[model samples]
Target: MIKGNLAGRMGRMGRMAGDSGPERVLVAASFANRVGNGLFNAASALYFTLVVGLPAAQVGAALTVAGVIGLFAGVPGGHLADRRGARPVMMAALAVQAVSMAALVLVESWAALTVVATVDQIAAGAGGAAWGALVVRVGGERPAVFRAKLRTFVNLGVVLGTVGAGLALAADTRGAYVVLILGNAASFALCAVLLLLLPRYPVLEAPPRRRRWPVVADRPFLAFTALYGAMGLQYPVVSLLLPIWISGHTEAPRWTVAALFAVNSLFCVLMQTGIGSRIESLHDGGLAFRTAGLLFLVSCPMMALAAYTPVWAAAGLVLAAVFVHSLGEVWESSAAFALGFGLAPDHAQGQYQGVFGLGFSAGQALAPAILTTVVLGLGATGWLLLAVLFAALGAVGPSLARWGARTRPQPAVAAEATG
Candidate 1:
């Protein structure tokens, strides 16, 4: 009797743990993926400009090419994710990324870097579609719960990766580039392993012979895509150019930028789930998007003004900007994730995510060149202008919210076939 009682008790505990098993696995895998990518972001510019002796503009140009290519890559990537289920697509893409990262570290030539960047981003685009769609599928109507959990893990990973890179830079580690690349490759492998623990789910495939770009014909959907894309464009300003501005204008240690970013990531990890859930629950997601957008507008000009203020005050401004920007990210991301699945039929989730990727690709691709030119030519004032552009994106969000409210829900099979 005692043996049976103990066995029953243990079984209950096992079920309790297993209930969260898939969600936890997805979150852990996402965390590793973000951490590895964060290292690449932290180190890549220095690797190219200082180590490889390439011009900054040249590096930006390469990213531009990658971004443009991603525009085309999205269709197939999204389609595959929906058609093939998230597991295989994510695993295969991560595998490719692992190979690419390894090559990037070993081959340091400009030719090699360019090739790696191109291939890596293509794989990344595919993986991103799968990841986003999987989040929706796994979380169902509560995408906020999943996204927040994922974001928290993502932030943790970013913190680890950035802090680690800061340490490498401080030590002037000889194999710093190799360390970053190898770390990225390992992270991808970990993502695969973590994903393996999740329950198997079918991929959401689009109908046979469905054409690409037709998604744009859905006006409300297109507006949502554009708004989300604009938000992504602002990320370069936050992550890439903002650091450059800090380095040039202040006596702040280079690692301080990473540190500030780490702080922001930590906060995001803590708050994203709650904030994302709240926003998703709103009857009008656009209102939440607008609030987030306005916050960013208020914050962006402060980034540029930090240069003119007292050094201590400038530091405060940068921190404030980071906080606000992170909030905007949470809002925008929550709406985007929720709508991507909510608006589509089960079968079309893949295409919807893919179509969304096109806008993101365009925005990110243009950001490097545009921000670099603005900072170089006009300095801080240029960034302020960029902020205004971001703020303006809020106007579009309301339309999307209204569209969300008004769009006619299609029959399930037609929704699947159309997607």
Candidate 2:
């Protein structure tokens, strides 16, 4: 009987991975989209500097400006998705991305680059909001689990795309770069086409006499966003701060940075679905967030200690710390999927998701400067402080999630019955 139960559970998991036709289509679309993103991420800087003859500083400045401008697009785009329908908005955004990527091949000047980049960023922000809403509709009962499955495929696609990028980077010619850019553009077009295969979702109706900007007015959700944003510092800690620390401060080889990244990615691909499957409720999510925070506490100190160790010891310590950090990342991400989806009203998922994304994006924008000043500047003391901050944020997650849940709008029937 135990063996039979285990086999049945495995079968259920298999079904969950691609339960519906729309879910499978969405997964394919997400994979195709991320593959292009991976290629662009690996090669865009080199292409702009070497092939297009643009200065590095100008490129950075343009990208920063574009990121800042793009932040505003999510809210309005999500609102539109709520009103018009997520599927149509998502297709429109993908179409815009395709056009913007094609335009990048023509960019020769900073002005041209900035304009095209800004448009691309805006489209990306809008599309992200629509995607979140669509996921809610397509995922049926277990959206978070489905999202986890999608992330696994997304990582695989990126790995594949990076391999393609490696060939382009090796060629190191204008033609190769142009081909890379066009490939990304084509991917976006293809993703849009794939999205068309999914069934159309009907527009969700808002509550009668609802606030004009209900998500904006949701203080509990806003508070949760702030905490989530604070915890998001973990991202830059891994990507930006650790590399600098490894190269300049630790006795470890520079190659450790790449190894650590690969470790993190592999962990995500392998473990994300399992972790997400476990966190099925807000309570589970809150606990997972707390667990992530505690893990961060343990890992951060180990990372700090790496700077003081000998070469071999430093490498071992850094590797161990990153392993813990990656586990925390999986837990934290699972918690986010649960809370981000659970706290919002059914009709306004797009708006709520957009607002939630604002916090993450804002944190991302600020993380580089913050990490440089705090962790890099202060050394061991900085790492401890950041760890404490993450723990504190995680510790409060349950209470704040409870608050958000309490504030959620009731169903029309329930409200009418209460009245």
Give me the candidate number with maximum lDDT: 2
**Candidate 2 deviation (Cα RMSD):** 4.1
Q: Give lDDT tens digits, candidate 1, residues 20-106.
A: 667667766887888887877778777777766788888877776766665676667867887778778888988998888788766
Give per-residue lDDT, candidate 2, residue 93: 95
C-alpha-based local distance difference test score of model 1: 0.72
Which one is best on TM-score? Answer: 2
Worst 10 residues of 2 by lDDT: 410-419
All candidates' TM-scores?
A: 0.82, 0.93
Over 1-419, each residue of candidate 2 has an lDDT whose tens digit, in order, gives 99999999988855745788898899889889889988888999999998888999999999999999999889889888999999999999999999999999999999999999999999989988988999989988778888888888888889888889999999998898888888899899999999999987888787799886888788977887888888999998888899998998999998899889888888888998878887866667778889999999899999999989999999999989999999999899999988888777778989888888888999999999999996789999999998998898889978876676566655522432342
Provide the overall lDDT of each model, using Cα atoms, as 2-decimal numbers.
0.72, 0.87
lDDT of 1 at 318: 87
